[model samples]
Target: MSNYSIPYHDIDILIPSQKFEVNFSYTSSQMPNFIDSMIMRLLRISPLSVKNIAKFLGMNQRESRIVLDQLITNNEVELQQDGLFHLTNKSMKYFTTVDSIPKVASILEHTHSLIYELTNFNYIAQKPDNNMYGIKLIATSTHAANSENIVRDRFQKQFYQLIEEDIITLKKIEGRPSIYKMGTVKKVKECTVRKSLDLHVDAQAEPQAIKVLDSIMSDELKDKTYQALGQSKKGNNIRDILNNLDGFEQLKLNQYFKDGRFLAPNALFDSINPIESKSSDGNHLFIGPCYSQSNSKIILNKIKESIAKNHQVSSIYWLAPDDVFWGKSLRFNTFINALGQIKTKQNTDLQLKCFLPMHDEQDRTSVNNYRKIIAKDQQKYFYGIKDGILDGNFELIVVKNEFAVIVLHVLDSEAEYLTSFPFGSISYDKQLVNGLVSLFEAWERPKDDGGISFGQMFKKHSQS
Candidate 1:
């Protein structure tokens, strides 16, 4: 362990004389051990001979000698040339010298006040490597008289400052039990700076969710859509038509204008630009709106690429809204068709584990089709929102241990035209994909109606 010590006299100079009125007394039983209390109290006034200590404490000389000899053996106390007993330097590190009675008294007073304010508190001594060092206050009862923040601030800034300069190092606070460790502000500052730099690098390296939105709303894509509209209908201009549409309808029309495969009035020029593909060694993610059939086809194609390369897809986890599986939805049709192709190529049934919102009237046909495609040996798990499991509207698709895609649904009108697009901000970041996989593994659900058994699925697929 690292040692941090300062002369008691230096601390004494910082304490006020008026605060000396408070008493700092300890009953014998309050000491950690009987031998410690006896030795501390005896050495506080002045060093003493073993015979003198034994006589004062009413013990035999031999018994006293044995105890004092043990203290010497443990390096807790030292014997001077005059044969007098005194505390070792190690012991002195914790307690102020007897000459600094006023400083000790002031500490006791603050401690008493803090204890009175807190209805309950706990202290956990941290290891040497821990960032925090020394006494740390975590929580106090709501009914307590003192404001927790105010009291902690005052104690940390004022009371601790006067005692020792090194004490200022212990400042990191966490929830529940308080943590204390030996650390300096310089070390903490360095750690913060390092973490900030790492985050900056991560942000720059990965494609952010916002970038997908930017691509979809680019002026170039908009201009292409406007031109396509003009060619399809004579004398119908972009401004006149856009003026009559709501924000959502305008975005939906813009997407359709780019990919004429979904709507009527086909365009001469193809506006649906493809994302630059990367090596499939690691996880890949794609994020963007998915309202059009063309976009759904793109997503389905990515999944086919993964399944085709591996021959057999070990497991598939999906989190999506109930509407995504509606019979009328292009996404539903595309997903179902893709599953059929995969099953035929592998000569085995497709296995899908889905977390979807509660079943609605529109989902009946799609859900029935889904059950028919899944393998007989492999079970299909469907988790409902009423179970209080899912947290967001974002769609997630993970293909075994290989890759995952997360597309956040755009719901509000703040993005105006962008809201009309089915989704926003897509990320194919490998780190994020792995984190989602772990999150799915750790999530809890009810025992009875959760879904097909997670254990059986894990045993079968985890090995792959």
Candidate 2:
């Protein structure tokens, strides 16, 4: 987790794989030896005494007898009642009758470990680490695509390939090795990797989340994941985090949440900037691929322009839970200053409703963080976002009947060199503006007036 600096959430999933104990049999040959080789070759052709074997090989009977005695000890030869040395069954299998130069060959069996993904029958690097925690178990149906026969076939096909790649370290491979037998295929756990979209304020642009290595999520598993998340009680909690999200943000969620969690995708910022467009109802849309340097300057100018044109203004401003409220960007303070000045000196009838997500009502850190962002005297104008949504990454500004801007947020509090801002879209159309107002209205003032005043929240925390 320390390696990745991007503000991201992750859901651990267990990918199914099989650990195969493969028994491989191959013919092995020892280093060359003339005396032992000739003696065995002679005995293999016909039963021969020490004198006959020595005579055929042009060697002394004494030396040949010593070697044959050693061969008998090794189970390669035996002396029969007929007084002749005979090739043992083990020795018979070791040499071909037609070969003149004898080479001792023995069938040897060795067990090797191999693992493959059960979902696709592809090779995995190694066995899973059992010490790791929080990995969600995948259903058995996720691996129903590959049968045991298919897994064995894939292992057989890749066996030589693995050796060529030096993944298999068997040095002495005899001619045309094969699987003598296979151990029972057992299911084991593997983990999906975590990748994040990082913010580099000094670099050209923040890098998007990259594709994870060896994603075991197949199409079937992904469908099951989507269905699971949609039905889970915890998934309903994620819905709270998504409240008032724009269409583009919603689409990103639908595309990336295939892991059955509220995890942002690697290409979270890959969405193309829609420069301008018209709504179905004929409203003009102005969009900006906002630069991190200015921090939503285009949208701020729009807000200022709207402020200049209107005297009595009604607006709703929603801030992301963490980054904006902590003053990571100076622009937030700047916006507050400009609006505060107008309300104080210009004496405009301005009604501004602001919302922030507070994780707990009595959390001292939340109360203090809110105080750091808005002045104690101005806390009355803000409301705490309700429900169980813990964090969000977008900001909304809706000036009723004037314009609305949805700005993607920068979540890294420690990032100094902000490269690129997510995006911002503004609309001046009356219907669009009214729709945004209604959206915020429902969120801020529900049927039971679910809104909790920031002033009261802070006071209660202070007392507690």
Candidate 3:
């Protein structure tokens, strides 16, 4: 949510593309022709007149003449001055001399299936299994204009290559062979495909689909999306058509930020005035060195475990501030790095609200980059940052109705805040937990309500 928000409207349009099934006829070498090969074999042994060839082959001279004429046209034989026929050099090409005897090849026709999506003329691999992939089929008789010609031309261009790649296998096409000619190409059936448009707009910018988020959509897909919108009779404008679509579902940008179960305050707890309570029992409390890298890592792991696997995290509230110099403290950086793991939990609807007060101007770049890490997913990760001062350095984390962590400097001294480690405790005590929750709610309330309204602060920063 680092981008500016003038706030107009945005949407995602999922369109099921139309597909047409088509079949085409092509020619390829199948097997050898008996009569054609026999004639060539006889000529290879010795030159023979058509009469002699017809006599040896048990055919009348008329039939033999027709056969010889075809052979001559194919350049397999030639009539010489001696009035006899001889095998031409071109005739040897068809012979499979790789083995002892040369074998001749012949051609046969084949019918194969090719699918063409009407939205984009590109031939698809096969019918997609998902219904959302493509829905309606265009009738063969009434399809997009010029689609037939385009499909035919593309099939022609890819025909030979398809055979070479075994997609359209030919038994034998040894010498350079060409498609004798194209045959009937017609749509046979229909198919389905899933396509979508990610559109956004506001008061300051014109309405348009945000292409950056949709790297999977090809240029052709974009064209089809627009074409579909343009041809729709439902509405005059894109927004109108989108809204008018049947079964349309509006996706809200603030869905993740909405207060769910975690933000539902209890009247009884709200009625009780919050008071700080300290526990001495070892089992209910933990005392540790804050600057200890190992201790910080253990805490990070605890946070990860609370949100992972079977855990269903409703929300998270973290109160951590920047150092006076620039960027975050080493311990804070350790926690920031761990946020990557927390930000990307697919199974959980985790909402994290962190308050990072920027104390120095140099902290801007580092903090912004840190924000960018989770802001990419604006739905779940929420944050608030502003230049301010606090009494002391501390780190606090609370998982709604789960657990609370409070780390604070035990002694108010520069050395303790610098090189020396602070003291902290992890507690699940009900009173202590309620107190922290109260503090968080107070800080999160709206500015008009005498609170910072950290939720709106994050939302504004995200859109800004």
Candidate 4:
């Protein structure tokens, strides 16, 4: 049908039945057309007439004859005296080459159940004296018992047969898990594949800020005290009082009568309870007792509101006495979610600063764990201060540089509290704002030249 041809003897050794080996030197770019590929693959097992090929391909006889004629002209197929078409030795060599097996295996792996059954048939077809040259796999109309087991058994048998025939290879490479290889698979010093773990949060998952906030607020009030103190002129004096108020008497005096001003527990709660209308203007700060998940959510919502109004939320700073309460009460996950929502829109403009006394090894470990769970991009916004700078039952959150919310814990000599709710206050006075802001800024500064930076701390702890 065409002029192109190759001497028959040159590729005689490529015939499958001859059991001779030949190197395939063709690149993937030179692969034949889909129809030719299918035709060659079909003829790999046995010769097929043009009509038979047409039937197999669901094509008309004339279309198949045209393709067969082109294949014959290219020396990819041969005409037999039996009036059948089969792959020439050259075509057989190409199909049987070890380089082709991985590609074939990949295709087989992607196929559904049909390939499982086909592999099983390939196993039986390869047995000595087996006359079966083709397999027809049909899906049963109804489910049958032991169907899965039957397929699995067949798949395993076929897998072993392929391994024995050198069509597939398995190797245990150093530093890598076991895997399958094509061609002469052998152990190597280095693994070709790299393994990693991906930890992801679903974007569609709703944040639980409201729920977490409610839970924290609903908890039994451990200690309550109300304060309405005027800003002290001497910043160092106030810092001294705060740092020295761990004793029962000092704790009580500071909690109940700060600067000779006091408010009832009910009044404190009413003032501090987040109101949407009150959040509209000015810089407000909320600082209180160790925050529960609920408290974190409430604070997060307030911060969200400030951001919504296009106000600059300067800082979220906390001072905890020890890591036990800090670790137990800090709702890192809930906070991350709420902050993530804001950051997704506004970015890392807000600052998050926390100062806790890492009194022991356990405290260091707990903080380290917290560092590991925080996202890398967010670590820049979050600063952790373990150096002892500020202490006592003090919680403070400042919003928009205008107001401050303070919570003081009331504790008696017996270590029991008079009320369940903690004492809280809201201050808009310029002096009080200045004093609190000054104190917060002073504490945020590094203790000495060699003090660890937040970035260095996160990196060192995250790796550990």
Alpha-carbon shift of residue 43 in model 2 (angstroms): 3.9
> Which has the higher lDDT value, candidate number 1 or candidate number 4?
4
Collision pairs in model 3: 1-462, 3-464, 96-103, 133-192, 133-193, 133-194, 134-192, 134-193, 135-192, 445-453
Give me the candidate number with maximum TM-score: 2
lDDT scores of the candidates, listed in order: 0.37, 0.50, 0.48, 0.41
Q: What TM-score does model 1 achieve against the real structure?
A: 0.29
Where is the poorest 10-residue window by lDDT in model 3? Answer: 248-257
**Reference-based TM-score of each model:** 0.29, 0.41, 0.33, 0.35
lDDT (C-alpha) at residue 240 in model 3:
23
Worst 10 residues of 1 by lDDT: 8-17
Full-model lDDT, candidate 3: 0.48
Model 4 segments more than 4 A misplaced: 1-298, 329-332, 343-348, 359-382, 409-422, 444-456
Decoy 2 TM-score against native: 0.41
- Candidates ranked by TM-score, best first? 2, 4, 3, 1
Per-residue lDDT of model 3, residues 280-387, tens digit only: 331122222322344556556666676665455566677653322112123334444455356425654356677655533344453454452333444245445443
Cα error, residue 345 of model 2, in Å, equals 40
